[model samples]
Target: MAKIPGVRPPDLSELTRAQDRMTFLYLERCVIHRESNAITATDERGTIHIPAASLGALLLGPGTNVSHAAMTLLAESGSTAVWVGERGVRYYAHGRSLARSSRLLQAQAELVTNRSSRLRVAREMYAMRFPGEDTSGLTMQQLRGREGARVRRTYREQAALHGVAWDKRRYDPDDFSSGDPINQALSAATTSMYGVVHAVVVALGCSPGLGFVHTGHVRSFVFDVADLYKAEYAIPCAFEIAAAGYADVAAETRRAMRDRFRDGRILERCSRDIHHLLLPADEPEADDLGPDVVRLWDGGSRTVAGGTSWDGEVDW
Candidate 1:
């Protein structure tokens, strides 16, 4: 039998940073295969090669067939591959996280498990939304109330500014088209936001299930992070798109969201904000992109070197 060589995966530092990559690229009705370091999408039109590391998320819509080699390259490049339904309204699955280190995940777990620390983190999240205002003394209920009012005001203001019909938000996950134009726009916009934020959350070695303000769901932390930029990006973009009276609200919303993400450098901001939330100000920064090292848990305060026998030193 002849021997075949496997493709060498790039070093973490050699790949493009998640924050610097394209927001997302959607493809349907195509066959995706690997060629060297890039993925090629072939269809009736032709074939297009995309550098795996340059992509933040690769959305595979309906009628898409992906080769295993292509997927492996995407994973190694830290580019998230999301399997979604038409217009990206339904999320089916996602690829592996880019994180090699568990440092941020440990910090998230510790903060979420303790009630005081959890509340403090929640307050910090709200504080980001309400700049120039102190939310340190406010209770959870108070924070929710304030946020609700602020969001409502934002919706009303945007509706009025865009000359669109103002109504309460209404969405049915099972039926995306049931809502009005504005509601549909909002849903589509937020869904896109979730996709991008999910990539960042996982790439940073953070657990999407461990959230500060939100709890329980697998993507609670994703929601927590997405909400931070809704007002600044998604909400306004949705309103603007809805007002334009586009026939395809969902499609237009996706394009608008992509532009906003790129123009505003939302990925960079998202990564920075997540780091700020998880890491303490005084704690020395660790190399998130450094080599993967496994350590055995000793206690909350420390960890011992892994892959070594400690039984001889400790007598049973």
Candidate 2:
């Protein structure tokens, strides 16, 4: 197949017809080595082996990385190479040039931020208390009306129902699948962005928890990265999933997310935008705060709010 002269090297391999095709995968949680028709992987649970030949498709990428040994094996065995790594994940130059620069990536990120902020504010302004409208409006009022629940009674029930005492306090509506319409709109917006963020995080090989937004939770800045894409990637996916019978009423799962990510209606240029966001040239130092969004644990997003300060802000 033809190649993009500047595209990152394709991860590939030749399945030796009964001859043995092999691949190696690495991630923060585990390491794996596999070959066509057979497979072996190592995790903290102590390397439980599995049959590798049965899979119809393999979706592997960054945040998860592979070892040099695996790369060497693929090179010797002529397998495809997929170099998705964390921000910290980098291999020395094997003589290949590089992707785009950080300035361009920052620019693209800025553009997406401006685009998404407008959608987010719009969704919040029209927070409706009931689900009277249809799904196509894509308006804020529709989002809030369809998704909100006062939950005042649920909190009261906890104290009265089973002698189980708890604060009858109202919680922040941050859960992606909450009943709040504005919350639903925000969730829809964020879901669409996950694919691009996932790809970028994998390429960076940095901890997804070390985020601009979100806390230093085990998941890392992964949610933060994913949040960046909500305006474009998530809204359409939510509507489609809703249309396909996964209504906007309940929570959506990651499985449903992957399906939506695979859908053809997604804007393909976002892949290029994702790639641009991960340009190796503009590597941020541990102390050097850059232009990316900073998501803190308190559900607030802003570099000025004691998270990593960014170069610009999108005021929608």
Candidate 3:
């Protein structure tokens, strides 16, 4: 069989960096099943293994019960979990584990605040449009075109906030990746990252049925967090892998994605973005995750004075 592209990797340990300075991610990568504790997964190949426990974030949503075996796994890991569209990148301390109450609270507050802020920006984009006196009975075609116009205007305005050129066609067709084996993998992986993030988020309880910015239709929340983290995590990692050049692009894209799993920044990003969960420890040994986990002064390491307590107001 042709080697399938797009390998998804999971960060084994939590790495939280200085708040706001590092890439923050909300973890979304897993197969969520209903009341099933036993996990059976096959790699790109048909080879299958029955895992002793559930994989990734195991969320037993409302009116659901996790199998005993799954519960045991949850108890042992004390892992934070997502509840199939109920949480929507939200994290809940594993019931079996002694969840760091204080840490989770602060993280959740900050992350929720951050998510809210971004969504607010998207909403503002809609509100700021030319809501002037026009033809009231405009057909769906007219309104659809208007919304597209609004989206472009919003993207440009948002891009300007970062001093970047705002254009709809960020990737040009002329500069397309090489048709060789190496570039193909990178391209596929890059294209797939959004879908992957969306899958995980939906499994973790982001209600596509209810959306703030995206329309609440056809699995809406899948790419929600991906929109927030892909640029920081997947984009750079894929660059490093593709630059090395390989025989097969699709296969390699999968490998590069797996490699990205080990990045500390990805973990930091996930913990930072999802609200209702205390942000993880960005700086090792620090109890509170303060703003600016890591910074550069003249491209040099800079540290802020404080302990591991994310106290007071947060402004990223």
Candidate 4:
């Protein structure tokens, strides 16, 4: 009898970078199975093949059944799998990270744990939102007020530009249809942004729970990163879609955001922004932030080689 050979997983270096891959691919009401390096989704209509390496995040929506082999391919390619609710309206959970090293995670932890450094990082985040404005001396309260004004101004401007009715943002997570078209659109767009940003955060080896501005929550860092582009990308897209008065606002919003993300190179910008926020400006950039290597703690910012027998050398 002939023995069946196992499928070989792609090397980390061989996989596509998160920034260069598709923003996301949403699959629903289909059976997902593996076909070599690609994943095939089959339903009554037909089957579509997607290169696992080219996907940044795979949104497994309602009725989507993915096989173990398909999941293995996704994990190996560093593609994040997000299990979401119907129409991708609600987020349930997410898969593992691609990071093999703890360098960025350590940096993030060091910065977030220190009060002064945490404030500095938070200011840097607001500075990004304000662009030319200097937030160096502003207190957290002042920063919050300033950000509130900016967001209000953005909402008003976008509403005016799109000729849509202006109203304060309001949405009910339990009932998607409860909100006005604009609010619904905003929710959908924001959710999509979070999905994409979460993927990049995990891929970079940073702890999503350790955030500079938004603390406590497990996805605090994801929120921090996603907010960086909310004004530039999500808000405008949402307003435009609301003005168009699409029958299926959520679906249309997702499609519009997907195109917007692609054209805007959002993935690339997101990756760069995250690195800038977590890493010092003087630190040199490397192709691989987290290499597939293990090390032993040598104390005080030092590490020794892993897999070594130090039992005899060290005093017991």
In model 1, where is the ten-residue run with the lowest total lDDT?
A: 283-292
Q: Would you estimate the TM-scores of all the predictions?
A: 0.95, 0.29, 0.36, 0.96
Per-residue CA lDDT of model 3 for 161-200, tens digit only, reads 4343323333333443434332343354554454344323
Residue range with the least summed lDDT across 10 consecutive positions in model 3:
16-25
Evaluate model 2: give its TM-score.
0.29
Q: How many clashing pairs per prediction, in order?
A: 0, 45, 32, 0
Question: Model 4 clash pairs?
Answer: none
Query: Model 1, 135-202: lDDT tens per residue?
Result: 99999999999999999999999999999997799999889889899999999899899999988888
Best by TM-score: 4
Tens digit of per-residue lDDT, candidate 2, span 1-316: 8875531322223223111211122233456564433335566677655443221112233434445544444333323333322311222111110112244334334433464543433332222222354334466454544443323443344335433334432224343333343234324334324433443333323333343334446443445444334433444443444434444422342344445554632323333333334334365422111233434444454324445554465555
Cα deviation at 54, candidate 2, in Å, is: 13
Alpha carbon lDDT of each predicted model: 0.90, 0.36, 0.38, 0.90
- Give the runs in model 1 whose Cα sits over 4 Å from its true position: 1-5, 299-302
Per-residue accuracy of model 4 over 142-180 as CA lDDT, tens digit each:
999998999999999999999999879999999989999
Best by lDDT: 1
The predicted structure with the larger TM-score, 1 or 3, is: 1
Report the C-alpha displacement of residue 262, candidate 3, in angstroms: 3.1
For model 4, what is the C-alpha lDDT against the true structure? 0.90
